[model samples]
Target: MIDSDILCDLILANKHKCKGGEVADYIPGLKNANRESFGVCLIDSNREVHCAGDYEEKFTIQSISKPLVLMLAILDNGEDFVFSKIGMEPTGDAFNSIQKLETSNLRKPFNPMINAGAIAVSSMISGASAEEKFNRVLDFIRKISENPTLDYDEEIYLGEKETGNRNRSMAYFMKNDGVIEGDVEEALDVYFRQCSIRVSAQDLARIGLFLANNGVTSSGERVVSEHTTRIVKSLMVTCGMYDGSGEFAVRVGIPAKSGVGGGILSLVPGRMGIGVYGPALDPKGNSIGGYAILEDLSKILSLSIF
Candidate 1:
């Protein structure tokens, strides 16, 4: 028996604790977000939803899409094949850092949670063209979230594509190393589009709920295999918060993935799924307010998997 009212009160009590962080400005469009905005949504095993603050606010999914896409890639092409292109280890460097890739003998991205590895995963998604591949991913996301109208934010997608020189370099490097097969631009296009998918806290909570149930929907249909869900959750626990993963695991004690757009999707294994949003980001690009809220909620609810 989870207490929805207590959760709402907790969010209101700690919303101001996130004032120290700044919004992500590197993306240009992400800079337009309201720094004070914060939202949270939680869905329990019984399908009950608890929401607080700006739960209805919409934002881009950003790097949080990595885990979902990683699961999709593994579903399309088994884990063994996907792991061959990207290592499962976390890189202590920044998520977009290419220096690590350049310096490593393996020349592979450290994990699917980072930019290089995600681009490699994007290339593996089955499709004849970039459009087809993107549509497939979009459809998958929509189905999992149970939101048929979910779609990408075109403005954010175009902005990212126009100002994505760093990502372009990563894609080309992976192509040269044979880690990514096919057109670099096409793969990048799919990656950017997936990152640009817009969702409210409710939508993200629904997606998290799907993962929490081991890829099963409330209707009991499995969208992804249990094995794939386990791998994705493990990656989220180990590398989902970029370089801040260790601290998050220590503080929150649950599997979570955060995006630069101030969204985090987290779950308490078989208990519930949580979605959080706050445009104010810590230096590591995680939602400051969102993190605080989750920390408080996890403590109160004893949601730690460990």
Candidate 2:
């Protein structure tokens, strides 16, 4: 049996570790987060929830939205069609680096976990216009997380839109390469809105739980297919942490996706889903304190997939 008391103690013990990292400030709105905030939530297959610290506090979902978006795209367009647009390999470059696309002859984004591929996948979402596509994404997330009230943070969306020159460059490059279809701005709008979806740690945990159970809810309703969930988890293990994926795999030994907003959606396949939030981030944009706490929990609870 998992020890909820120990998990809470671990959170409290590791909360002070936030001093070692800084919050993501590139997206003007993300910089407004409290640097000291930390939270965690864990839900097992039985739907029992264990939480600690500020798990109730809401934050932007950020890049953690990538895997979810990828699943949606695969469901909409099928895997073969989607993979034809983006490569499955992990890029050693930063998530937003445009140089990788320039250096690669294929011009396809490395993986959906990165910004370029995510933008491409967003374009593939079934819709006639940007608004329709974004609404589809919003509905999917709400269904997966079981949170009817979840919505985008318009401030963050506009902030990302205003300061998204790099993303714009990537979209245009992909358009030139024929990797992305439709209007670049429209695709970017869907991407930005999806990333800006606001959720608390508990919401993420619930989403993770769905993934943990192979795309099924606690009530036994199937969301995504088992094949889709398997692919998503495999991608998370290989590329979920951006360039730091290998290190995360070595340390945590579970599939997880981290966001610039300091949220992590992790799962122990068939066991539990975990959500972590620490506004402070490491150089690679992962939650520093949150990572440490997960390491502790994985070790103490033998949660590693390996």
**Candidate whose lDDT is highest:** 2
| Cα deviation of 268, candidate 2, in Å | 0.3
Candidate 1's C-alpha runs over 4 A off are: none
Query: Relative to the true structure, how large is the alpha-carbon lDDT of every model?
Result: 0.91, 0.92
Positional deviation of residue 129's Cα in model 1 after best superposition, in angstroms? 1.0
Pairs in steric clash, model 1: none
Error of 2 at 61 (Å): 0.2
lDDT of model 2 at position 160:
95
Q: Which stretches of candidate 2 lie over 4 Å from their true place?
A: none
lDDT by residue for model 1 (115-197), tens:
99999999999999999999999999998889899899999999999989999999999999999988999999999999999
Instruction: Give all candidate RMSDs, comma-separated.
Output: 0.9, 0.8
